[model samples]
Target chain A: MSVTAAKGFTAAGIAAGIKENGNPDLALVVNNGPRRAAAGVFTSNRVKAAPVLWSEQVLKSGQVSAVVLNSGGANACTGPKGFQDAHATAEKVAEVLGRGAVEVAVCSTGLIGLLLPMDKLLPGVETAAAQLSEHGGEKAAIAIKTTDTVHKTSVVTKDGWTVGGMAKGAGMLAPGLATMLVVLTTDAGLENDVLDEALRAATRTTFDRVDSDGCMSTNDTVLLLASGASGVTPDHAEFAEAVRQVCDDLGQQLIRDAEGASKDIKIEVINAATEDDAVEVGRSIARNNLLKCALHGEDPNWGRVLSAIGTTRAAFEPDRLNVAINGVWVCKNGGVGEDRDKVDMRYREVHIVADLAAGSETATIWTNDLTADYVHENSAYSS
Target chain B: MSVTAAKGFTAAGIAAGIKENGNPDLALVVNNGPRRAAAGVFTSNRVKAAPVLWSEQVLKSGQVSAVVLNSGGANACTGPKGFQDAHATAEKVAEVLGRGAVEVAVCSTGLIGLLLPMDKLLPGVETAAAQLSEHGGEKAAIAIKTTDTVHKTSVVTKDGWTVGGMAKGAGMLAPGLATMLVVLTTDAGLENDVLDEALRAATRTTFDRVDSDGCMSTNDTVLLLASGASGVTPDHAEFAEAVRQVCDDLGQQLIRDAEGASKDIKIEVINAATEDDAVEVGRSIARNNLLKCALHGEDPNWGRVLSAIGTTRAAFEPDRLNVAINGVWVCKNGGVGEDRDKVDMRYREVHIVADLAAGSETATIWTNDLTADYVHENSAYSS
Candidate 1:
């Protein structure tokens, strides 16, 4: 299962002179199919990008056949001009593919509020269209990245059904609905309602649980398209689980590639009175910069963990909470229980478990350790 | 004014060996007057620290003669034993000062959930008692620091009345209520109710508007003591404003001293429909790490400003919002309108203004720019 493995899909990526480094800055994915059923989830931020606003309205018809994405210049905050540029790109893609403009989706990332270089972007789109191929998925994935050191792609397969996805986001991640740009493709037939349900459920625990820096993005979007090429549609529960698996995998990759992050951390909260409470507890810890930095330094600072958990409204007596760092129980019943020296956080993966001793509810959040590199990358980002 | 500038107060600082570096860790502040009228505030976190819990109970009587604070171990989650240590510390202070144990307040800050070093603490208390003086405020301020680059102090005087305070907190300073450990002294003759009202009002607009990293501490406490030695008490309104001024000054100093901070940022939200709306908008921008980093780099990233403002429930039309970074109107009517490069951010201070176009209500928040030093400081902490 690959981004272009689905039937009737062709993809291409190329250097568009948008990025300073001249890396692949343009990507295009096309659907040369008889069916166009699409759904998209956008950022919950009220201050949305012009492209997001345009696509949000366009996707209301539940039909999308192609997507045009570019890096190095986020066509956001450009107002009417930005909106027109997005519409023009969609029209250009539709003209080349002999489809209506409304059937095309557009996504842009990079420095915000910058106007797109349409001279380069239009020709780049043409070049991408001319070079479109089924094996272009990997290149497309590499084209949409900003500070990410690695490309993220995932695919799920089960009994004649396939779901492939590619995502790009390294910062401005926090729990809400979506935090980045993701395109998912499936060859299995799915009703609009089924797709919506599966997408929402998949995002609830995956993309919605990643808080890299607790900064929500304005251009975050996730689109799902079903081609029904496999002629096999699993039940709703099964299909939802498969989609969740894909989202989970992609979400993990996003965290691993977080800006200046050297380690991926998982914060798990268990035995909460309610799922929301558990999630709140987990997210609170995930968003704590001090805790993230301490984890980056391989310091088992259980005090920060307890302090973070204490800020949440979860129903747990402080003394009844047990905390484990790196698989070593450093705190039990709200007191020092294990030797601090026993916890080793020298690797690129760190895990923290908190038992609330209330009920059988749990939540796990993915995050990245805060480091000087993160500060450096972000501090100098806009310059 | 200094910590010891208040009449009838004696203070001392001593090394307790609790910190590995053997820095001055134990501090004592005593009120020698017969009237022990005190008002206090604790952290807003539901998970109270042991010292917070003990002090909360003691402050219920509105009488406190002395406060004993120790840095290096914030005995927050040490369970019953932690509470015992706090009580024992207060008892030792009371015994040394010949006051009732119930009249003593205790506070601790540093790593959490560790047992107190009884040998070091007890001897340190004795040494502090022996060294107590009317001019030990600077020493006490330096004693209760953890990762703080400098001490914070503020004083306000009107006529024959005086109010002075010292605060210690550099991080974990998001607002629920209070975010640091502060002690205020006054020689004005005021009742407990007046002091309480003034303290609450001052904290609401001061400490409550500072968001360093969006993390709230468990051991945050603020104590206000009035010795009535000045034999002069101004009107309640005038005294309250003075207290607010002092708190505001200290709050600004705290933001300036934020870990790895290179610039102090002020986010002002104006034309909100209500005060709450204005505060929410201000806080959203103050908590955005990307925006903070952009400020650190002196880049006028108005897109991040809009995205952050969009996260709040403030009743404002997105398209009607206007934004200015460092006095340069970078965005007008929710879109870029001015030359972003015209904004100058070469100074250590920054000002961001968001016009909601709803009403006349306004709120301002103080924050710090994210920097590599912040990451390094927090990452290496506890290591």
Candidate 2:
């Protein structure tokens, strides 16, 4: 159970003949609620996808009865015709579900610059609505995968309410949003404003910090819907913590399942002048291809870390900086410290701590190593 | 002849026992001039190498008698001892050449965070000074190789004047300077201020735009020395053009010899709102890992180009964006246009043009395709 774990929700996933390889390409989630409330976040990339534009408008009404997602085409950079297609998709879903089009959201993922196969997708919406079930959450999670090797879902329960979510992403992952589609559900009887505040506060530190590739996408969207089935309006802080926990779990899953990744790196920047500075330093370290390659080879190259930090405008003194790899302080006071050979790196997880020595702020960024397999996977992806 | 193509320049290269493999690791280039006028540029990286710090201070006087370069260790991130070593190397070079220590510049390249072998290096400087000859430019070029497969040199001869240079760099290349050491010799009877203006203008469009792997180095230095032996006093514009030509040639050589690169890509952004905008967009396209990998596989994935453009704050509308790969406009009006199959990419040189349709400014950046070999080379480089 993903969305349905929170109660008062049903979902369906089906093959819509949109994918040439006959993979499941369509998913629908519906809220059978005494009250409907929703919040959403989209990619900050200026060139947004057609479904992103449609869903952004639907979310403005602060109510969502259903969400339809497909994984065979991104429907991005497709011009006005693509936006029209997204609107048409929402209308079709509304017709099948007996709801207003404004209460339905649409999402798409996969190859950009191609129009979706409406002929197969429109009829599949009826078939999916006819098969809606509480157990269909897992299938819905699986249907949104593009290069993801496994479906990701996480849940957190309180005394009387719960929050759960599913995410799909593997490559082209970065900040503002990764190239992903996420749907979260809650039965905490919260209004749209409360949901919006909690969702924003939770995602700010969770999904927004995952910078796997430093590549922002045009079709990233995350959404949350409340059904009020539990009828318990919990404290805002507790509900927000649950949302953050689920989002953090899903983000970890995204990083662990990153494309062709051999190692998952966690860069933590400490003693920064401000949170923004810490984030800047963390992102710079996360995006350094040379450093990533060095980490992949298990070389404790502190110089690459220093070079990455030098490129940022964060507040830090070069001679006062320090770096630790795998809990070994390989560099201290901007120079060689402990013996690098003593650091063990045979594990799949690598942790790098960069001390800015400026103030008392910290931020963490998650990334993966640069490997030959990454080049191979991306080089042959479109062809 | 390389630097010796110009008058009043003598150079020598020798195996200094600094490299374990007995490869040539020390080079000395002396400007035997009646008038010694020089200008230099160093890496903008805040965490600069000890050699870079030493050379930057020497260049402040607008006079340089000689340049000493080594390839065994970068002498970076080594703290106070490294700075003393760099100073000692310069002092030894000045003593051997019978000049003041302030007139000698030292450069180093290799793995960072290691101290130089002063015992071998100081003795090698004396030997290099004794063996300096007008025909040693080729050997001097060969001595500075790190991962470079071949030596790089360029020369431009004009009426009674010549500008020539030698460069060494194979990896860790990006804007604000590549991981390179360049020494330019000119016998055109120019002042340090004139040479400074000319060198800055030349590098701005040439070396500063070559962004391979988007990884800046801590040990980049470019120096130009004028001997004033030709007695021509040629037109300033003509001399500047000659300097730019030589710099452009050397920059091209560096790109062609970029480590593990199989294809050279020229990204030209046209019709931008400003030249800065064009440069920003061009650099963004040049540094896109997905686009580079796709180009390596000969796939005209125009969507990646659009996606890269979307990430920048440059002035361009999504629908008005167009991209052409290898002379075929694969993406027009931000969507699919001409057939991608028509864009032939079967050559070692790949050309990409992004039309912003915003203004009339233009800029070009040179980069290389990402390959498995790049990962292999950089991953095992320092290990």
Candidate 3:
């Protein structure tokens, strides 16, 4: 169950001939709702794709009836003509759905600096619209995949409402949003203001903290739409919790399927002077190339950890820093403590705890190990 | 020619049994002069090695009699005991040379968080002192090699004066100083203040701009010692230029010898609003893993370059950015320009020019391509 797990939603995925390999490359999700309340977050990168520029304006209206996504060409840095293509695609989707052009949001992924094949894409949109069904969520998830090896979906159901979503990203996963396209649907009868607040709060911790690599994308987008089909108004706090749960689950799935990653690393910074300091320190550790390589080799090299922390502006005395790798406190008070040889790292998951001994603030950032396959996959082609 | 290329200096290198493989691991350089004016720079990383902490204090007097460097272990994150060991090493050198302990500076490179073996190190200082000679500069350079495949040295002879130095580093090379140890000696009769000003100016543009892998070290140190043997004080501007030339040459050597690097990339950011902005954008592009991988595969993926520029806070409009790879403009005005297929990247050196079109300021950064061999080397064992 993907987005279709929630009521009043139908989706479809179809091959659009955009990719030469004949893979499914077009997806459409529509809301048959009494209320079309929505919220969205786009990439923080200043160099945005044409589709992102279109979607940002569509999200400003806070009412989206449908979302059209494709995987082939990013349509980014393509100048004014690319924007026109996005506008025209939205217009076609609106014409078929009997909705306004402004009510349709567009998202694109794949290679940057290339224009989409509008002749094939326009026809594929009509085919996708014809195939729209309640059980098409999985198909839609499968279609919006470029290098992703598997499709991702998450569902969280409460007493009378359900929140569900889908995501696709295998690389270029970093803060300021990973290279991803996520669409969440709910039937909990929420208004635009509530949906916006909940989506922002949920994504701030989930997608914003997952840094598989220190590279941001130009087409990152996360949209949350409410159809109000359940006709049950839940408490705002409870509804926010359900949205956060779904987002957290999807974020984990993205990390598990990260490109060429052999180990999933969880970096937790504790006792920071502030939440921002914790985040800064956590990101510094997450983006350290040497430390990531050492962890990939299962070396438990805590010295590299201390060196990374020292590069940050976070408040912490060098002599007071402590670190634990996989439950072994190998470094204490900036010196050797437990034997590093005693630490076990035979699994796909690695946990590191860095204690600042400064205050009570804490944060966690998810990342992946740097491997030979990562270099090989990213080097072999332009993705 | 190495540090001893100048007059009134003697040096030696020997295996001190600190390295288990019995490679040369200790070096010594002495100033036999009427003046011992000196200036030094160390790593900006806060979690500094014990030798760095000790040498920082030794340089406060603006005078140095000798320098002792080792390659077997980096005594960092070892608490008070490490500091004591650094002090003891200085005392041993001072005793053997009949000088005050405060006049001796120490440097160390290799694995961090481990203590140096004083039993072998102290006796080795006596052996180095006994073997010191003006022709031993090449041997001293070889002794400071950790993972460096070859020892590096540079010399510039001017009108009645000479400047020469040696450096050793293979990885963990980044800004705020690469993981390197360099020593330069000049026979010109100059005071400490003049030496300090010229050394800082030289390093600001040379060593500090070399970012091989974006990983700073805790044991980086560069020192300049002046002996009054030449009895000729050259023009300040000419002296500074000679020093900068030597540093630039040594920095290039470090990048060429970078671990597992198949290509060296030079990122030039031009027409920025300020020098700081140019440097920031250049570094952001230099540290981009995706761009590095693309260049490693000889693919002119200029879109990745645009994406990296977007992440910086530099002053530039997205639609005005331009990028050139190997003199071919692959991206212009933030969109596609010349055909990427026309660009040639068969050589080991790649040049990337980013035109910000904001102002007249410019900066350059040197880095290396991300390779599977890099992962293999860093993962095979701890550095």
Which candidate should be chosen as best, given lDDT against the real structure?
Answer: 3
Q: Which CAPRI tier for candidate 2?
A: high
* DockQ scores of the candidates: 0.80, 0.80, 0.88
Put down candidate 2 lDDT per residue, B132-228, tens digits, no spaces.
9999999999999988999999999999999999999886779999989999999999999899999999999999999998888999999999999
lDDT of 1 by residue, A121-236 (tens): 88888888999998888889889887778889999888998888899988677877445789888877887788888998899899999988888777888888887777887888
User: Candidate 2, after superposition: displacement of residue A49 in Å?
Assistant: 1.1
Better of 1 and 3 by lDDT: 3
C-alpha positional error of residue B47 in candidate 1 after TM-score superposition, expressed in Å: 2.3
Whole-model lDDT values for every prediction:
0.85, 0.92, 0.94
- Candidate 2, residue B53: how far the Cα is off, in Å: 0.6
Model 2 lDDT, residue A67, Cα: 96
Better candidate by DockQ, 1 or 3:
3
What is the DockQ score of candidate 3, to 2 decimals? Answer: 0.88
Note the residue pairs that clash in candidate 1.
Answer: B260-B374
Q: Best-fitting candidate, measured by DockQ?
A: 3
**Residue range B16-70, candidate 3, lDDT tens digits:** 9999999999999999998999999999998999999999999996689999999
What are the runs in model 2 whose C-alpha is more than 4 Å off? Answer: none
Q: What value does the lDDT take at residue A193 in candidate 2?
A: 92
Compute the DockQ of candidate 1. Answer: 0.80
Q: lDDT by residue for model 2 over A145-202, one digit each (tens)?
A: 8889999999898998989888999978899988899999998899999999999988
